[model samples]
Target: MFKTLADWLAFDVFGLTAESSMGESVHFFIMDITKIFFMLVTIIYIMGLFRSFVSPEKVRTYIQGKSKFAARVLAIVLGAVTPFCSCSSVPLFIGFVEAGIPLGVTFSFLIASPMINEIAVVMLWGMVGWKITALYVASGMVVAFFGGIIMEKFKPERWVEDYVWKIQMGEVQAIEQDNSLPARHRYAFGEVKEIVGRIWKWVIVGVGLGALFHGYFPENWAASLGDANNWLAVPMSVLIGVPLYSNAVGVIPLAEAMLLKGVALGTTLSFMMSIAAISLPELLILRKVIQWQALALFTAIVTVSIMLVGWFFNIIV
Candidate 1:
């Protein structure tokens, strides 16, 4: 159905020759843009509704006072489900700290929140394969879990901003009650509009880049540089991805393009993970909450964890 529509739009509507590169690129752009935005709107709305039921205060309460192991686990799970973006990381971090959630556990949530989101999972499942999506989720959870534990062992509480520790949220409270069904639906729609509106441009840009690569880029270029035999490819990809910031949805299409050009799955995934999880923008956001030393440690931990995941996947996959 989708292919037929794309074909009709490209050949009949646009009058592009069916087998031409321009025609293929347009078809891919149209199909991917349609499929991705549909999934983004639908999934983000549902997740937002889920978010409505679970407030930040509740999250703080749930993770506070738990054993380290249990707290880390719960934090990872909560982070995976939360709907916030990297731009909201500092506020969330402050909230967690004020709620008496441990710094390490908060780190777990922070790392997992942007790295392993609903849109990333849904898009990976739709555009990539289920096995790849499953692997991405599992690896992300592991990175969060161990990264939190390592940070806790180092005991970097002093590295947190003194202001963060002083701020308190005792007076603030979660919603007194849930909104009416109509209100809830309206809120969900609002969330969909906000999130989709924010990301639709990036999505289009990503798909455009992907389509360009799919139709015009030289196939052997990435293959030569990022082939499995090149040990430096994984780390190089991670290093390159760290400075660039984009959500998983924005970067996945480019990653898909790389894979089609014969980049190893591990290298491509590592690039996407680094872009989503440890970008320069996130680092700058976190700087407000954590001292330089702690920020360096956090970056080191996540970078090393991502590199290991990349190498492991390259070997096994």
Candidate 2:
């Protein structure tokens, strides 16, 4: 249905030849932008209804009370559900700490928040398939789960900035929320508005890049990266992605294009994860809460873990 609409607009209405690169790119862009925004509004609103039941303070209290494994699991799950980006890192990190959540478990939430989310999952399912989406979600969980455990082993608390420790976190008073149907609907609408407003530009940029790659990138050049012998592709993808800042919403379209153009599955996954998870902007924000040492360690652990995930997928799939 979307393809038909895009084709009409691009080829019939605009009168561009279907064979032309500009026509194809225009179609790709139109189709994706329309489909993505429609899905985002509908789905995010639904998710927002459930989100009203969960708050950051509540999450912190729950994690603080759970066992080690449970805390890690909860953290990862919450991270995936929350619509947080790197911009929220500093305050979220501080809130977790101030709430007395374990450093390791806190690390898990931090890792998963930007790297994996409902929007990304839905977008991937639409662009790729459930099989690849499952793989992506599984890999993200594993990285967050283990990354937290490893950071705990490093005695990460010692590396936190002195200011964080000095600042006292007072007890939070829980406020009752309205759970009436109308209120829930209002919350859902607000979420749709806020989330769509925040990420719509990213969706445009992402789809634009995807369209360009789909229409103009050399197929043979892209295929070369898929070669089994190209071991460096995984690490190189990670390295390149680290400095770039984007949420999963922005990166998924580019990832879809790479896969369509013959980039190796694992390499593409690595690039996507690195761009969403370990962006330099995120690290710079984290610097305010943690010292240089902790920041370096966080970067190293996530980078290495992402690289491993890439190589592992390359080997198996």
Candidate 3:
């Protein structure tokens, strides 16, 4: 349906030849923008309905009472299932700190939350395949799990803002929620509005860039990076991704373009994960809660972990 519309607009309505780069780019842009937005609305609304039952406070409470390993696992699970992006860092971080969640557990949640959401999962499964999606999810969880453990080894509590320790979260308030189906529907619709509003511009930008890549890039433009001997590609991909700030909805289309243009899967995954997990904006937000030392260590550990995941997958797959 979307393809037919794109073709009619680009080739029939616009009277542009399919062979022309302009036509191809137009078709690509229209097709992806429509398809991705449709997916985003449908998936986010469903996830939001499920999310009405859960809250950030509930997440912190669940992790608070568990043993170290159990807490880490629970944190990672909650993080993956939750709809948070890296932009949610400040409030989530503060909540965990105030609740006295362990540094490692909090770190696990922080790492997984932005990197392994349901949108990313569905998008990957649809565009790439279930295998790559599974690998991505598994790698993200592994990185979050061990990354937190390693960060804890640094005794990161010392670097937390003194003010964070001083701010005591008062008694846990059980706010009453309307649990009727209409309320859930309203909540879901609200999420659709808020999330779509936040990411619509990014979706356009990402698809525009992707269209250009798909239409204008040389067929083998990324061939060198795809070669097994090019060890620099994975690290370079991560480095390039660190400064760019975009959610999975924005970056995944670009990633699909890269894949279509012959980029290696590991390098592409590394780029996507880096953008989702460790953007400069997220770091800046985190810096408000933790000192430079802890922030630096967190960055280094996660960066190295992502690089390793990329390198390993590149070798095996």
Candidate 4:
């Protein structure tokens, strides 16, 4: 159905020859945009519904005072589900610290929240194959879990800002209350609209870039740089991705384009993870709460963990 609609728009309505390059690019663009937006609306709505049942306070309470292993695990899981982005980092960090959730546990949640969002998972599953999607999620969870543990071992409490320690959230209350099923669904719909409105343009830009690469860019150059035997490919991709910021939804199309142009699975995934998890903007947000030394340590831990995941997947996949 999607292909047919794209075909009609590109060939019949746009008057482009079906076999021409422009025609193909337009069709691919339209098809991808249609499919992605559909998936985004449906999946995000469902995720929002699930998110309604959980609150940051609940997560903080659950992780507080748990065994190290349990706390780390729970933090990672909650991070995966919580609707957090880089913009929320400072406030969430403060809340976690004030609630007595360990720094490492909070870091685990922070790492997983952006890197493994439901939108990213669904897009990966829809755009790539299930095996790759599964690998991405598993690798992300591993990175979050181990990264948090490594930071915990370093004990960087002294690096936190004095103001962050002084500021306290007293008498935490659950942010959301139980509502009728219809009300919850209505709230979910609003969430879906807000999220889609926020990222839809990026989604288009990503898909347009992918379409251009698919139709115009020379494959040979990309293949040479992304050569599987080149050990540098993964690290290079990570380095390139870290400085830029884009959500998983925005990056998926570009990732798909790179993969189709012969990038190694590990290299492409590493790039995507870096973009989602460790952008410059996120670092700026963290700087508000952490000293330079702690920030550097956090960055190092995440970068190393991501690189390790890339190399492992490169070998196994």
The reply for model 3, stretches above 4 Å from the true place, is 85-88
10 residues in a row with least lDDT, candidate 3: 48-57
TM-score of 3: 0.95
TM-score of every candidate relative to the true structure: 0.92, 0.93, 0.95, 0.93
Give all candidate RMSDs, comma-separated.
2.0, 1.8, 1.6, 2.0
In order of TM-score, best first, we have 3, 2, 4, 1
How do the residues 1-317 of candidate 3 rate in per-residue lDDT, one tens digit apiece? 98999998889999988898888889888888888888889998998777654468788888877789899999999999887756677778888887778898899888998899888799778767898889989999999999999999999999988888787677789888888888989999999999899989888888898999888987765788776568899999999887787887788888888888888888988888988888677888899989988888988999999999989888988
Clashing residue pairs in candidate 2 are: none
Q: Pick the candidate with the highest TM-score.
A: 3
Tens-place lDDT digits, model 1, residues 1-317: 66787888988999998578898789878778888888888887877666554456667778888887888898898888777767878878898887777888988888898899888899989888899899999999999988888988888898888898888656655356566777677888999998888888778888998888877777677777567878799899899988877778998888777887778988988888888998777888889988889888998999899999999999897
Candidate ranking (lDDT, best to worst): 2, 3, 4, 1
By the TM-score metric, which is better: model 2 or model 3? 3
Lowest-lDDT window of 10 residues in candidate 1? 169-178
Residue 308's lDDT in candidate 2: 95
